[model samples]
Target: MDPFAPPPFGAPADLGEPDPRDRPARLAVGVVGAGRVGTALGEALDRAGHRVVAASAVSEQSRRRAAERLPDAALTSPQEVVAAADLVLLTVPDDALAELAGGLVATGADVAGKLVAHTSGRYGTAVLNPLTRAGGLPLALHPVMTFTGRPDDTGRLSGVSFGVTAPDPLRPVAEALVLEMGGEPVWIAEDRRALYHAALAGGANHLVTLVVEAMDLLRAAGVGEPGRMLGPLLGASLDNALRLGLDGLTGPVARGDAGTVADHVAELARVSPEGLRAYVALARLTADRALAAGLLKPEDAERLLEVLAD
Candidate 1:
């Protein structure tokens, strides 16, 4: 049960020349759900010299995709994929993962001696309970990167952080797989999986919402090309926030400009009522953060809050 020890399930028999990271011999890898994540990870592992034993997708579109990514890998049902490979990656939609696990276990697909992992960020090892009960090691290793349905997704695998959650018996294998995929592994407790996913959603998904709202505002103001004007500023602001921490925050909220805040809310209410609530909510949150950062005095923060609340 040593967290750093490799699992007994997927160890290769020959133990040939060690990989660059001195990992245990490459395991036969199988991928289920040949969507973007599955295809990308399969191709990256294949490129890293792992044996891609099998890959399967529920639809013809997914099968074609897996074929394009790993032409030599067998295409079969999910149960076949699980039975054929030493390590099975369930990359199906989060909602479908539990059912898939149950199906794999019901079919008696050698779960007892396999390493089972999933790309779902929401549920941890618990979603693979059927596999776990059958003695398969369950791991959640979600890559913190966006996936586009393109053959070149392998490139995006490099330099990403993978949120890894697994039992102590399976941690090393999960970490090694992350390394094999050119990603750094960040260990997370299984119980915190939902909270971790929520954080990611708030940051990545809501950032898109904020940007789209900005674009809409710009368009309403008659800007012909808002993206061109906003791109550099957005990039620089992100860079500064990352490098300088909270001290890098700028804008009316950071400056505690209550008048400007009121003006923005008023303008949005008049011109874009649909965006008003989001703008106010986000502004209030930013104001609180600004207050905590010492960028806004208490009185100014209070006034800004009042303006945003209105």
Candidate 2:
């Protein structure tokens, strides 16, 4: 499975002309590091009617997988991939991005006049400096969604918001790229990239941690299938929260039930002492939200905070 090889999948659909906002030139797209994110994004662009001219992967396995999924796309070296495409997506890991960009520059992969982008949330256009200095317009366009290794991963990309950051001149192009992928584009300042990424991580990554902790507690409480027991409740609560916003909040804290809060704290301390800290932290945060929502009076919030703090 050479990561650099094009997938044996059927020919990709024709990506229409360059995004209408883009210069009338049809930009050749090159995907570097054909891993899950790269492959998924490539497929998405293909579906959007963009030309995915070439793709490269660091491993032979990835190359083969890429070949199977993007049979019409060329399998080549990272440098060659960039050279062949007018737009280059460096979807490699965060730590490896700088090295890969530097490698491409060292190999004289003239990135000048190219639209260079990466899917890293942790880095902004700075990581693409090597390419930018060589005349490329560097941009950071990260999709706020998860990707697995499946070829159909592109489906998850639809309707997702992409955090886009690029220079003034490149902003329109960056936004157009997001639209081309059927995603909403939100422009973020380069300096605020960390803050933007942190917010996403807090909601997505930490939510997963909170759910896992809840499941562990449930299992310890004699639940044979924690997920089955928690899934419906979690899903309904999430849906309600999204639909009704803060007004959808309910539960002991929202009702200012001090006794219930104390009981939860005591139970967490007894079952999972480490988890108690998280419970306390989240409760305190929720108390503030409840107060802001006018669901909890100031006094009630104070009382709840007292109980949560302990």
Candidate 3:
């Protein structure tokens, strides 16, 4: 079978994911905020055979991005974007989403019977209450991937998980849209949206901080190419952690080596006083996990706890 061949409509593919051909009929897509995410999704949908009719871009950077990704889409105001498309993507920041929706309604945007989807991870369909009240179909479809507005951003959408939350009757529509965009839909309840977003932020966002701190330390220790050195080690550690959870831990804290951990704490305090607090906190959490997982003996954990406390 040709990997790129289109799947038969209404038939499950080899991976059992939703078939891309099973999506709704082609519709005119509109992007309300032509930021990195908005343009990327718009481009992906365009690749899936939907027409990008119009896009709203306030900043020069956003306008440039929309030009590159949705070249055929007319640059217009937010109200005009909503008025021209069958599906409107609200890609604004999380805090500004509700206000944007309210403003669109107040400005007399024609949203009735249109599919209004927001790309906010923190919110569900509830944030689009204004649009819904105006007879719009609301969908909360958040792609679980970072976007830098580069040419590669749209390509990254393939097979990425989308946190989807919609009314029970609209679940299929929500999932179908994700499938069309080359994303897998993971159904998220409205109440669990915050928790789901928090988990992603804690893991992916905090991991960046931790890795950058490690690079800074490596440079201080005279390593010229920190990324080259950390690349393999971090890659393996991430793989192990994903495959084994707590069992993948192998550092001094996981091994209950209080002396080594104490040395680390002392060195951090002396060399990088600002990083000492985060080190201590993460070390304590690691030790607790190791102990609970039975990887560290009770006697050994007591020494580790004392060092952490100090």
The C-alpha lDDT values of all candidates are: 0.84, 0.82, 0.88
- The better candidate by lDDT, 1 or 2, is 1
Q: What does candidate 3's lDDT look like per residue over 53-132, in tens digits? A: 99999899999989988998999999999889988999999999999999999999888878899999999999999888
Error of 3 at 48 (Å): 0.5
Q: lDDT of model 2 at residue 212?
A: 97
Q: Please tell me which predicted candidate would have the highest lDDT against the true structure.
A: 3
Model 2 TM-score on a 0 to 1 scale: 0.85
Tell me the lDDT of candidate 3.
0.88
Q: Which regions of candidate 2 are displaced past 4 Å?
A: 1-25
| Best-matching candidate per TM-score | 3
Using Cα atoms with residue i matched to residue i, what is each candidate's TM-score against the true structure? 0.91, 0.85, 0.92
CA deviation > 4 Å runs, candidate 3: 1-24
Q: Whose TM-score is higher: candidate 1's or candidate 3's?
A: 3
Candidate 3 local Cα displacement, residue 32, angstroms: 0.4
